[model samples]
Target: MDIRWITAFLDFEPAAHERATAFWSAVTGYAVSEPRGEHAEFATLIPPNGDAYLRVQRQEEGPSRIHLDLHVDDVRRHADRAISLGATELVACDYVTLRSPGGLEFCFVTHPGESAPPMTQWDGGLASAASQLCIDVPASRWDAERDFWGGVLGVPIEYAGGSYAQTPPSADRPMHLVLQRLDDDPPTVGAHLDFETNARDDEAARHQELGATVLDTGPEWTVLRDPAGLPYCICGPDCR
Candidate 1:
């Protein structure tokens, strides 16, 4: 099962879908496709050139969160491989949804010839380029989660710090998968999108202008909430 494509999906509530779509389009410099699906809940964020790597979906239930879509040559084979590596199957339909060892949910879908979008360049010395899907793992599940993703994706896990591990991007696959070990008493597991920027403050300000709020800030990254209340991050220059 070859991992042919990776997509970062922004799941939003129905009431907030429009706002979320508009905000993300402005931030990433992409155009949103017409809504598809039975309830018109699914849409793609299309880049001016190249294939789309981002999508938006209106959730029928639960709060907004980020999830990944792995497009593979064989969905069933990929799902089986993931399950054998400790992922629990959640659904098996047109696509297969599985929860990783660290608790982050992702899906295996048929390849649609999608490819990573090229990084956009912004003016004002605000270089907000490249996007990353970060997997938040509990400290206890960190090692297993890292190993699971590395094996499933056929990528090497590169340790950045005591708690940070990431799979470097290759020419064929441009998206990155980062595993971050949390320090919470009972660590929480989830996924979030991260934007690499040369000017964090300026880029964050731009996002604020587009209706996103800064939830928190650290030495290297700033946490933000979209109009739909989904949390994402803006990491500093070192992000890759």
Candidate 2:
């Protein structure tokens, strides 16, 4: 894919729409763009500093999840290549909606941009950036899904032990795209937001105070569920 930009969309159903929007807007300190789309269900979190890469979409009904959009120069050209790499086409319009082999939904669309948003600095000196999208793939589909993503993105795939792999951060590439092979099937392929922060504990606490619930804690990250029940993580030890 000749990716020019990327955006991660957080999805929620009608009932949780307002809460999801508010929590994320507060967390990222970005102003929300007016909802667009035919159903008035799309909005962007316009970052104060750099290019915007975060958005929210309201689904009629479904569990809250995140999906990625690859903005390329030629939508059809890149999308055709994506299909050749085993991405199943789900819908097509001005953009192509497709699912990777493991099933995480994504789209190929045209948008013009280069720089990604910079790390947000808070008043207390805590800094962080919504810098990654972690896709959860089933163990059985790991090989195919991993190859599919790497093939389509045309980025070097780096491994972290046996469980995690990621497309290393590139200055002009959008967000860090990661793949996590799960032990068993998860019913569907899904993704979660990952934010890198200098102060993990404090950052997690900040989210908790703003309506997110702590889900679990790990050696390198803290898992949390926003009010919409969408699981996201706060990573630490580095702000990159």
Candidate 3:
């Protein structure tokens, strides 16, 4: 099973342009792209092959559109690193959750025992996994959702933690999964992306086996919803 990239969005309300830029840059160690306009919009400048980005947009209230999550090799180590870097611990459960100086929330969950490649490419270990955005669900319901995500889609829940549910990818590929309850909001539907098996016949078989109900299908993409009314879709390899 190949795991691909997962993208997330953040509503940076009660935040200023300069502060947001600096905060995200410091957190991800990536440069900030110039704003397209003056209303405080920015995109993270990532390496050409990197899988994540931080798109900061002004919000009237706060974070209505998305919550962020991440997969870490070791949650405790990175969470400590984040804290040392001036990130504050927000929620500490099975995994460690932290907020940037600008108040953006994210968490780090250790991917399980399976041996993944190291962060280097064109050589020895696989690329080290670091992301700027993740999907957050409720911590309490993570197990249920993990089962549903696995059962509905015929995919295994590869790695799990207090607030995270990960689906590992095949060797030499990327990874993606959802984070549960990084906040205190009530349970509601969310839209996300999932990768199915490569072959059309195999993907279709997995879709039916996983209980995925199709909402839209295009030559390049197929949109569907999970059992809990969440908006999730399957895409061809190029959709990344």
Candidate 4:
């Protein structure tokens, strides 16, 4: 399937919607576009350049989590193809909503001309982009889920070791996919955003000042909980 563009939706419960939106806007240095969608539950984070690909949604229930919205020339066609592969369709039509065999949620929508935006530059020569979507699948479901996404993405999923398999990043693709196998099988699958930053220490500090709680830090990445209670990571000083 030819996925022309990809958008990451950061969904939060009603109580934390506003705060989460603000935090993400500052984190990516993107302006929060005016709210749209029925009941005013949707908005896009408009960047300084390029069509917006990050969005925010106010949820009535469910924990704050990230979901991918894939843009393509033929929504229904590609969507059906995904369903034919291991994805189970949750909603049907020109725009489709479905869950992967491993249970991660995603959508197919009509494509427009959108190019990936340049990384936002912060003070002190720090640069960052919320560029990768790390899909956390339980160890038992990794094989099926990896195969499904790899087919849908029309790319090879190469194991990068340490329980990680990734589709090589392409300039034409807006979001890169990384499949991670969890040691403990949780009740459900989840995804998180990873910011590739040149100055990891400084970037972590900036995010903390914006109300993110640092949960854990390691040599490779530092995990933090956003204001809305969703965990994300400041992953590198150029390390993937």
Q: Estimate the TM-score of every prediction.
A: 0.91, 0.95, 0.39, 0.96
lDDT of 4 by residue, 18-115 (tens): 99999999999999999998889999999898778889999989778889998888888888889889898899776899998888899999865456
- Please write out the lDDT profile of model 3 over residues 183-222, one tens digit for every residue: 5654542434444334433454445455546788777556
Worst 10 residues of 2 by lDDT: 167-176
In model 2, residue pairs whose N, Cα or C atoms come closer than 3 Å (at least 3 residues apart or on different chains), thus clashing, are none
Off by over 4 Å in 1: 112-115, 185-188
Q: Highest lDDT, which number?
A: 4
Where's the lowest-lDDT run of ten residues in candidate 3?
124-133
lDDT of each: 0.83, 0.85, 0.47, 0.87
**How would you encode candidate 2's per-residue C-alpha lDDT over 67-136 as one tens digit per residue?**
8999887888888888999888999989999988777889988875666777888979998878888889
Tens-digit lDDT track of model 1 for 1-240: 267888888999878888888999999898999989999899998888778888999999888888899988788988998999989999999899998877778999985555555667787646665478888887777778788998788778888886788887655665677888888624447888898888889899999999999999998889998999888899886687
Query: In what order do the candidates fall by lDDT, top score first?
Result: 4, 2, 1, 3
TM-score of 2: 0.95
Total clashes for model 3: 13
Candidate 4 clashing pairs?
none
lDDT of 1: 0.83
| Model with the higher TM-score, candidate 1 or 4 | 4
